[model samples]
Target: MRVNAKSQKPKTPKGFIGPIGFDLPSIMPIVFAIIVFFSAVSYSYTTVNEKNNVLDSIESSIKIADILKGNSYLFFDATDSGAKNKFASNCEKAVNIAQSKNINFAATFVKLDSSSSIEWLIENKESEIDSCTTADGKHLCWCGFSPKKFDSNLSKQFWSISFPVTVDVKPPGSGPEDIYPQSYLRKIIVVVWK
Candidate 1:
């Protein structure tokens, strides 16, 4: 028997089915949620990277301050005139390095004789020097930064603390009236916003 063409149904092609459809309202929320999740992740990553960079800069500043302390000792040990000159040159070299690296520092060499001089040095330089104290009429040479400004977010996020170094000196004489030649090196570092 011949099949009737008028009653024949069309056949669907294999492997040509379209994507399944869902209600737009139901699918939109999921898509939006995925987008929001990715956005939050990207933002968090960028923030972490920025904080790490700030931390690295602060660490570098501290290391540079320590290097300056070592140079100060070398300066103190140079007794000969020529050696002293060389020491000064070395100090300049260290200073250049610090500047090149964007590390800020201030240094002073003080010879303690009387309480007046010690007080004077402390009064004039306390903001920069982390600490200054007098003992046996000897003054301390201190190197440090004046004021520090840091990233507020990083500071709060990491719970960081400030710890600075201070150098002390001992005088040869016993009384405040006598002068002393002994001195020591001190270092301090502060992280501030530029």
Candidate 2:
């Protein structure tokens, strides 16, 4: 008996279109929709992860700064040897606090000396910084780094703040003119990474 092989159905390749209810054009939109949906989901997931990473780094840095700020601030005497010791102790405390939380850190104060020269001093320095007070450079301006030096910092998320050091939080005023003038300011810089 001879078989009519012409009437047999042919197999469709895995990725090729097969004879179905409609042509490929009708199904193209569904395929495109699935692709777009997945792409959107992936993009959103990545964006959220990046934002969380930045937020975490910044929050940790703030915690570290708060540790230092709370211990000894607003009274940073750049010219006094005793004050220098206190600053160093505070720096050690800040570093330890940060280290305990698994965060690497370094902090220093940069101020103008008696001769109008910049003094780059760290926490554990024994410099007889002459009375920097009368020389219009008595404020405590600080710079900090986390995970690495400022120049070698690899993290994209970081924060830096510099303002005149004041004994009062708001300068004891309520009017706009009473607002504190930005002069002889103290600088504080902080950076973080994941």
Candidate 3:
């Protein structure tokens, strides 16, 4: 027995310290959970970025519309007929400017009240006068016109002619000729920017 004890090796530590007995199953669930958490975080970040881009586009369109409205009102307020004519001519120039800057615009003169909703005023043709009354019953007439041809892509045609707008207008009696009726004549300009 003493001779055999030297030949045989002592029993190795085989409980928790043995490589074959190590538990890999205990670590797998923790690794899977960490992977799932990172996936969810990435998805949420992508969704928020897309929403912000859409909001920014809408804001830019609104700003362009405001600028177009202001320029139209100032042109209509000019004193001389030649100046008004020049102003009307400048609509094309404005369109060119916008096009150069890569902004989309459509201009139209809309009547406050009319039997027909959208009447396109033919260039070089006189506009048909229609009776219009304000909320307070001020008697007026208006003619709708636009210098730029209607392009389906940029124009938002769903709006009403009576849409309320904030624009300064010279009173009917101030100018040599009344470019606009006493009732507010708002030029509704719609913008769509890509």
Highest-scoring model, lDDT: 2
Poorly placed runs, candidate 2 (over 4 Å): 1-17, 20-26, 71-84, 111-155, 162-185
Q: What TM-score against the true fold does each predicted structure earn?
A: 0.40, 0.50, 0.37
Overall lDDT per candidate, in order of appearance: 0.43, 0.46, 0.44
- For candidate 2, the per-residue lDDT at 54 reads 67
lDDT of 2 by residue, 17-95 (tens): 4566447777799899999999999999999998886676667677766655553344434333244424445556766
Candidate 3 segments exceeding 4 Å error: 1-31, 71-184, 187-189
Collision count for each candidate, in order: 2, 5, 0
Instruction: Write down the lDDT that model 1 would get.
Output: 0.43
Point out the higher-scoring one by lDDT: 1 or 2: 2
lDDT of 1 by residue, 99-145 (tens): 67665544444322222332233335542222223333222334434
Question: Residue 156 lDDT in model 3?
Answer: 42
Q: What TM-score does candidate 3 get on C-alpha atoms? A: 0.37
Q: Ranking under TM-score, best-scoring first? A: 2, 1, 3
Error of 1 at 126 (Å): 3.6
